[model samples]
Target: MLKLVQLYVYDLSNGLARQLSLQLTGKQIDGIWHTSVVVFGREIFYGQGISITHPGQSHHGNPLRMVDVGQTDIDEETFEEYLTEMRQHYTADKYHLLDFNCNSFTNDVVGFLTGGSIPDWIKDLPSDFLSTPFGAALRPTIDNMFRRPIPGAVSTPATIQPTPQSARAAINASPDPALASTLLQSVASQATLGPSSMAPPSQSTSTVAAPVHICTNPTSFHNTLKTHRAVVAFFTSATCGPCRMIEPLFDQLAHEKTEAAKLAGGIAFAKIDMGVGMGGMVGSEYGVRVTPTFIFFLDGIKKHEMKGANRAELTSQVNMLLFEAYPPHPHSKVTIPALEKVSTNPILFTQVPKLDIVTTKLCSFVDSASRPIPNSQTIKHTLSSEFAGYLRGQFSSNGKAVRSSATPQMLTKWTETTKTLVGHLPPSQLFPLVDMWRLAILDNVVSSWCATAAGNMTDPIQILIVKALSTLRSSEAPSTMRNYILTTLRLLSNTFSDLTLAHHVLSPSGKRSSVTSLVITTLLHEDASVRTAASSLAFNMAAAIQKVRIEQMRAMNGSVSGLDEDGEWEIELVSAVLEAIRNEVQNEDIVHRLTASLAFLLRLSPVYESQLAPLLEVLQAKETLQSKLEKGGCGEQGVQNNDIRSLIAQVAESLLVHMAWDNTRGGGIQHKTYRDCEQCTL
Candidate 1:
């Protein structure tokens, strides 16, 4: 009781017809037939008919010319030629009339022909077309054709059933189900099989876990290891605050996740302590200027990477990879739909929710230093307390208790809000907020907080706060506050001097006293590290001053014969400072500062040897110089006016002796023999 099936072959050709003949009868068909019936079991299958006629002819012209066809038309003679050519090109046994398209047609045709009773051809088709040898080879080619509907066509029963299965099989075979799902989900609703149901069981097991080996150095991991299925490497540093925040998350992931734990077996997780291990060489190798960079490897080969402190982003990427490796069960009751196929008008995906939290935290730390406090007392408080109340609102300790965190963005909002708050306060109270920021530079915790804040604040006022503290000039600040100021200023100035207000302060006359005080204090500071910082700052200041002077001199060169009086005054000031420095060069702390400063000066202005000669003389004459160096009882411990006056006379005498030699013209007693007589010592 086999049923007759209508086979609608599309874009049919002689190749398809011959393939069908061989598949059905195991014998090659020799000639073309316009309409034909093939019998398999007790069923009869009819292919679509084709008729060829002369051009411009009505239904009947010279006689209806019958052409070879399965579903589409072909000329009778052309069909015969095609058969001959295929027979010549392909061996008799190798040639088949049916490729994948015809084979698909056969399955449906057999099913219909048998009246829903499975035909021999239907029974012969592979149970799992995706895994079958023939299905694997031909499934992709068939799938592509079925995705787009044929133009100017209506769906027929035969076309509807076969097309979708082929298309779905191709999608299921892809390596990345997420990517494949993304592509296939659009048409998935129309599909008989839902997305979740199609996924194989292997895709369900991948979950990211803790890393195995914590390599202090990644290069060592690369050097030591030979083969690994996957490797996760983290680049971090101890001083990087963001790294500190993210390290716990990375540790937690490595410790708990099965995949990360077994990474050593097939995957390996490694870490690079950029501060100590690689000397930051690995960072350069990986183009990681920032901390908390994660790199993923497969078979010890790098495949993916991300940088930043967002734990969720890292986790999302890890989860995506894990699911890809171990897909959800295809037959599972719980299923996730495949992603939709792409369209020109694609739907945009919103970013995950957790990113906002991460951004808030990062922004909070960046602007922490510049944020104005409510009062002076707040400065003495611990950082956790200053922002504790704020933290209570932003985070949840156990998903049940919501807390606020003083993030940079929140702080910025607070700053804006506080402007209104300040309006209610007396004008006298306004300056105290600025003072708090100044005080923050001293307390290590506050200083670190400020440093973190500097990284986040976008508002000009917040930026200015960081800039001011960074460039704080010793002379512009009150003397009582100067010591604390220098220490805080040193902390910032040593590392971020280029961005600090200290550089700008050195450029102006009004601020020069502050600059001078800073330099002097640095040179006299008891701490070796502080002395070093002061010396460095002094060098930077001197270089800046020299540059300004050079530019001014260049501008005035042809216009004036003598040096500008203002310029001369600046030089004199510099010389006086130099003299003061030279007088104190014997103090061990000051000596290092002076030597470093002098070296910087020598490098900066080598041509000013004559101008610098006196300072050099004092330095060179250390033993006598120290003995003669008198403290002016002026609270400052260095040379005073009397010391300067005596040194100048000694210099003048030296000049006079030289002048006398020149006047003598190589002979006779010098008119004035300048000598340091015992009376001068008195």
Candidate 2:
């Protein structure tokens, strides 16, 4: 597998040179250059010595720039050996202020990995500075500051010690004992930093805001309390054994409530250790004398307190606190049986085509475009080689294996390349690109990146889909637009893989206007393929809403209904879907999905009887669907047809029979007994 390589550039002077260089050195020096080679999730740089850390996590703070160097196909074992061998040439004692420094090390690594070097501007910064007369005068002062070692200066790699026995045993048992042994010695001799490379990967790849906030001082504690509408504080001390026993459970609660915790005025989790430095002062202020005390705060005031490591009580109190802060919606009081039984999983189109063929078709489209994009040959190579290799390695046919996500640097390069090609290609020729993206998004990493790319303003995937849909609606060549429409719908349906993106796309103002309009328009298209694809998109939207309601119902307990809180949008969806079903007479598959969409939209809805039930009455949904049941395709032609007929019958009964029965009773709508109603029966 090929790993992406990037050059992380940092300023050692931290912008001081930018402001004071003219006054101090009598020359304009933008920064004191510091660079690192970022690959394999580790940032490798030389400073007082060599060090490794998670990218962007060293003491230098965030990087000034992340330049794409290239990629390396070197195996992990071989790369470790290379780094071990490079250590002898770049030893700590031989380091110099101007000669062999961080930039020198990065340049060598870049050349070794990609047969290329770091940018010339960065590599020659020292020369550029020394060329000025003023810079030449400060040479002795810089040398003294770095070379005149003070007492108790931190030791370098030459003074390292041996590895532990347990660790050595584990290394010996590893598949490649020699590689593991070499890596351990290298890490021990150099300053090993961050988490262990051999540690198991985390299960979740989605980047969530830190679920818990560690507060060691009064200022931070007060700030968190004032910001969040609800706060849960777990106060403990180092010497307390019960505190250790309950810490994991406390962390579990924080992660469980992370979604609500990320809202603007949402709840927050804070941890305070009384045994630690300013932690004692903060805990004392709250009259906390015992370890493992739990406190609940609302609007920055104490509301409740518990005084033990009781797991059950902690869980219950947290739930009640959440319930108090965000009460169940008013819609939760209604009852609708048919809507309750609807499935919550969205309908996804996940058929994968041969990636090699897709790459060929895409390259052909780009090769023949009137204005070719820059780097056309390189782009084709990436599609056929690196991109294809990445997807194939990450996904398998059985689909049971768990895989890690692409690194941020890799994702950045892929998006930039794909976005350029997409912008230059015509809509009619975008089918292949859209198909590739449809498969790419099945990987959650790409889906998550596209969802948050530039806050969706310049999201490449969304732009591609919108452009294709615009063409599908207006194109005179129906034959040419068929595949485009089909792939575009599948791409939209796949957006539900990340629920955050799915909800945002279906938001009141975001993608609603364009996506809903296109799906509704295509629902009545002449081609059966277009209609099938459109129905799948419609079903996905409904299923997403249903999923949220079901989750809300579970969270709030079964006493109330689960509501999506958007009545206007639901009404529009129901109207469009009912019309589509009535007009769709030939395809049982299309009717099946459309009927399921209706069932999900009206199911467990807080306003089903009030808003949706009356809309059903106005549309005469019973007569429309009963006629569908009488259509020849809905008869006993096959097992699938019978299932479709049964679904239609259930939907009509819940929508029309319940509404008519309530109207006759002169009472507002209520959940009536479910049975065969005369107007609608399978």
Candidate 3:
């Protein structure tokens, strides 16, 4: 056992310091000798003391003691009067006599000189004597005088000798004091204190050297990017499928691209494994939640960011940005013609028929609806026939010729008629017309024209068709109309699922609900994208929910077993959906939604513990199969690391309670039935 002494000293005046030094060290000293001191303007005001009693001694060899001290300023007489008052009211012990306040002239010189039993009068002194400035100063010194050093003290000098110049270097040059203190405390049991306790160990032991790596400061990644032309950073995780997919591509670019290779220099395309180490910290700092995220930097400043895995698109964008920064050929900026010149020119403008003619005819029919012979039904019949005829004419050969010859002004007239028709009809009637245009007219009759005029359409009429269908899906539209809307959504989702077009339409930040609604509706879509997207969403959302559960578990000081048994099942379901989508990229949104749904089930269920084993087994099997395929065969090493088998065992262990109950119910059966099987060997 070792005795430890902790000293806290406060000095308020010079006289007490001299007296305390004389009494504790048996000598008059000015500076620290064997003790540590805290000076408050040169007065010994506070101190702590410790003493170790040897084995079989009266104090019983318990090797620890603690003392406290405080300092104050007061005249000797006043102090003595205070001490007398405290002695009468507080302590009347031998220790109290040792702790007292007095001036050099009036001090009990005999008590200071002789280490003997204190007088009864002195023993009755207040324990609060140390509260005075003089008493506080003497307290620590008195306490430390009884302290015993730690046992088995050994002196081991530093192995590596420092030069005189090195010794003069700043304290931080070696290692930070805080870090060194931590290292010392961690290995104190194995280490020996010496005069120069700050020095490194004398023995050239590898075990001692291992901690250095843990203590070394991490390299500053941000600082190294300053001199590079363009910094390309890849954010990835060990478990991210897209991240894994794009990693090799990035590696190829890092090796092949001349400028990129040069920029990489000795950095060697370092990877931040977001799964572990400082990588997680960096990812959090940069707000990275998804993997396969690439950040492009110019002179250490982030210029562009791409999230999700599109290797080719990422490469192209990087190349384009680099070209802009360092172009091979220079060209003058192009200027645009004045709007007035283009608008007023005869080549650009052409007169067209007015819509009033059509509007007047339609209004006249409406007015005649009150008559018995031709009422509202008759009026509607006439308008419908005329509108259909006009629309049919617009789709004929002559209509094609007129459209071909039409100028921007004439096209504008046609657009106005379409807008008027859309605005005049009720939603109930307009939905069908919109569907007809989308299905029959847009792709066949009007596609080429629309394609040519796409850039010029200030407000996209085609998007209007999508909007009308979307409205029908949400409204109390007729079942037939709703089915048509669903069909339209399915067609659109199918057409855009494999292309970047869906991403453009479904981005949460763009065109408001146009894309969001598209994605949400597609989650329920018959197409695979619906399932795929749903699964992916579900998986990501599950991770978030599980993280919350983990935090709750930690707050409650719960065991990991409870978390694994109950919380992990939902996580597994989400993970499975994500894994499925990773393999089947065609219907990602549907996959996301499916994953999210499973996650919801897990979140709402308390029987998650009961379901955990089976879920884990299934996931483990899938993972094992995937791993084996990735490795090309189930080699001995591969078989040994079969994750599914291990997970099954873990599940069995977690459900041991239920298994034990079953065993108990079966006439105290101790062995499982499988153990006696002919094919089994135990």
lDDT leader: 2
Compute each candidate's TM-score over C-alphas.
0.23, 0.50, 0.23
Per-residue alpha-carbon lDDT of candidate 3 for residues 1-682, written as tens digits (9 for 90 to 100) = 2112222221222233343332222223332111121112111111111111222131111212212222234334543443333232121111111321211101221111121222222222322233222233333334332222233434222111131332122111111223322322322211111222222322221111100001000132443353345556777776788887886677666544432222222122334556533455666766777887777766666778889889778778656555544332100111112211111110110112232344444445344433333244443443344433444445444535332222223334444434544444434334333333333222222322222122113223445545544564665634434533433443333323221222222222222244334434444444453344333433333433344344433432221122122344344443454345334433323422332344333432334434643464555533433343233323333323333324322322222112111365458764322211232121
| Minimal lDDT window, size 10, model 2 | 200-209
Which ranges of candidate 3 are over 4 A from the true structure?
A: 1-415, 436-457, 461-480, 490-503, 506-512, 522-682
* Cα shift from native, residue 657, model 3 (Å): 26
- lDDT of model 1 at position 42: 18
Model 3's alpha-carbon lDDT is 0.34
- What is the lDDT for 374 in model 3? 27
In order, what lDDT does every prediction score?
0.36, 0.67, 0.34
Question: Model 2, range 391-444, lDDT digits (tens) per residue?
Answer: 666655757644555554565566667677767876667787777778777776
Q: Give the Å error, residue 635, model 3.
A: 40
**Model 1 Cα lDDT, one tens digit per residue, 215-262:** 333334553244444456788776789887887777666654432222
